[model samples]
Structure formats: structure tokens, C-alpha cells
Target: MSKSGYFVSFEGIDGSGKSTQARLLADHLRAMGRDVVLTREPGGSPGAEDIRKLVLEGDTDRWSPETELLLFTAARRDHLERTVNPALAAGQVVICDRFADSTRLYQGLARADLRGLVDQLHDLVIGQDPDLTVLIDMDPKIGLSRALARGDGEDRFESFGGDMQRRLRQGFLELAREFSERFVTIDGNRPVEDVFADMRDVVGARLP
Candidate 1:
């Protein structure tokens, strides 16, 4: 809830329902007569969308952890420049499905150094952190199973195995601890309507 506008982010492991919650929040705001923009990381802007396909679907045999981090940040930079910044400048609430926090959790904890280059790059890419970040926390096994059941072949990253997904979940918790003021952990295993109700309460209290 900056003077400029709200930059709220939703974070969680795959199949944690972040996208669904983000859309629900945006729709709630719009119904209340507030202008809102709902977008996602790695594939928001056109340039970022192309990069996303390469990062998610392209060959990863040659891709190192650092390379993965760099690609995600590049997409974030483009997304911020093209979509997020413009929407916020126009005083619209920008609800992003994922942001730098995802990079911190995925690359930082699962792939790369949690204390090194990836964290530094995250700081650089997201100069000012999100006004609020709602983390839809859930069991990694459940989340991954849900993702697999949705019928998309495992991408390079998603195919990292169950242990990595568990680590990534811990990584998100670590981030929430560090940024307690901005991070809200929500139990995502509940029914969709119940989760939506909690999300509305959180957003309503913070949004102007």
C-alpha cells in the first residue's frame, strides 16, 4: 500500500493455488470499484513470455543454477518495466502471481547458493519489495502431486524430484521469517471458498 499503488504478490510452490488466489483477489478488488491488474512472473510481458518458454520448456542440460536464476530475474525485470510499473503508476492494484520471492525460494534454496549470488540478484531486481506477499503454504508432496495430476509434463525444474520441492518449501518459510512484515502465510489446503475468504480479509485490511 504505497502512495503510488499496491504491489501485492502471491507466492507458493507449484500447485499451491497462487494463481487462483491472485485472480480471486483481483476480482474482489474490481468488484469493489478499484482498478486492478492481475499478472504473473516469468510470463507477464511479451519479452518475458518468450524468456519464460525458454526457461521452462527449453533444454536444461547446459543450464546451471546460476543460469536459471539469471533467466528468472531477466523476466522479472522485463515484467516490472512493461507491466507492473505502468499499472502501479496509473494507481491500480497490481496482483502478481509470483515475484522475486519465487526466485529466492526456487533458485536460492533448491538450485543455487541460498546465501550467495541468487539472493544478491533478487535484491537488485526487486528494488522495493512487494507491499504485501501472501504465501499459500502447503505440503510439498501434495502440491507436487496436484501439479502432476494437472497433466503438464514435468519441466526441467519441476522434475527436480521431491526432495528439492521440500527444500523449496522450507526456503519460502525462511523468506517469510526474514520479511515478516510483508509476508503472510496462509494455509492453502482448505477449501477454495474458505481460502478466498481469508485472502479477502487480508487484502481488505491492507488495501486503500
Candidate 2:
């Protein structure tokens, strides 16, 4: 499944700086004269963007856990086909803000028996996983506090209680353990520059 380009993903609870660090990695790679494509799951392609709104903004009262997982998979499928696979085919390093892991952490951990569904979707739709996944590990409380401080209105998942967030955090750590070879767990309590620097080093080692 190896390709000429690398696929890197950033994962973490809200406000753990996955998006910021993902952009930093992409910028750093581009500065090194590498072709880099920066994209995000749930909204990379136009069709996925439409699905994103449905997942984030639409009412959840009618949404079951399985349904939520399917919507995310649908968006991810569109994103992969439209942005990720093509960019990699052309030899571009692809750094994504979030991917299949988020669904596992947020939905699978939050909802009962949903992890299995997410896993099945990964096997059926995602097919190829990221070559490297930088997991920004942080306390759920700290992460949620930071998210609220940022003043962005709470999204569907962010609106959950502390216990749920704690479970999600644990889920991420568990995943990191289960996929140790592909996962790099970063201590996210450090300053943003330090975190980005650590990430840069990891990506640097993988470059040509």
C-alpha cells in the first residue's frame, strides 16, 4: 500500500491544537520543497462539505449512533476519493486535520457498540490508513476548557458533559496503544511552539 507520498494525520480532543499543528506541518513540508496537500475530514470535498453541515448542524434527536457513524464515513469516503487519494497519486504529502480516528474516539467511545461499526466502515471505505498519526494527548478537562475558552459555539460532540469527554480521551489513548507502531503520542500540555517543533521533527525524519 506504499505510495510515493506520505499520509499524515493529526488527532486529539477539541482544542488540543490538531488543526494548528496540521497546518504547521504542511507549511513546513512545503518550505522544504515538497508537494503538500492540506485537507480535513468531514469537509475536504464539496460533497463532504455538505455532509459536514448535516453531521454538525442537523438535529441529533433522530440520529442514532449507527447513523452518525455512517454519515461520517460517507463524508470521509468523499474526502478520500476527491482530495486525499488523488493528491497522493501525484506524489503530494497529505496532512489531514482529522480522520477516521476522530470518529472512533468521539462516536465509538461516546456511544455503545459504535466502535465496531466504525471499524467496519474503516475496512470498507477508508481502506488505506495514514502512514503516521500524531496524537496530541491532553487531559479531557484541559482540552474542553481550552475549547470553551476559544468561544466557538459548542458543536454536537463538544456540547457533551465532562464524563463523556473523559471517556473519549481514554479511547484515544487506548487507540494509541493498540496502534503503537503508527501512533506518536505527544504531550500536549507544552506550549504550542514546542508541540509543533516536536511534530516537525517527526515529519522531518520521514521526508526524502
Residue 181 in model 1: shift from native, Å? 0.7
TM-score of each: 0.93, 0.93
Reference-based lDDT, each prediction: 0.83, 0.83
Look at candidate 1 and tell me the lDDT of residue 60. Answer: 46
Per-residue CA lDDT of candidate 2, range 122-174, in tens? 99878878989999988888888887687543366666657777887788899
Q: Candidate 1: misplaced stretches above 4 Å?
A: 1-3, 58-62
Model 2 segments more than 4 A misplaced: 58-62
| lDDT per residue as tens, model 1, 125-156 | 65767899999998899988887677654366
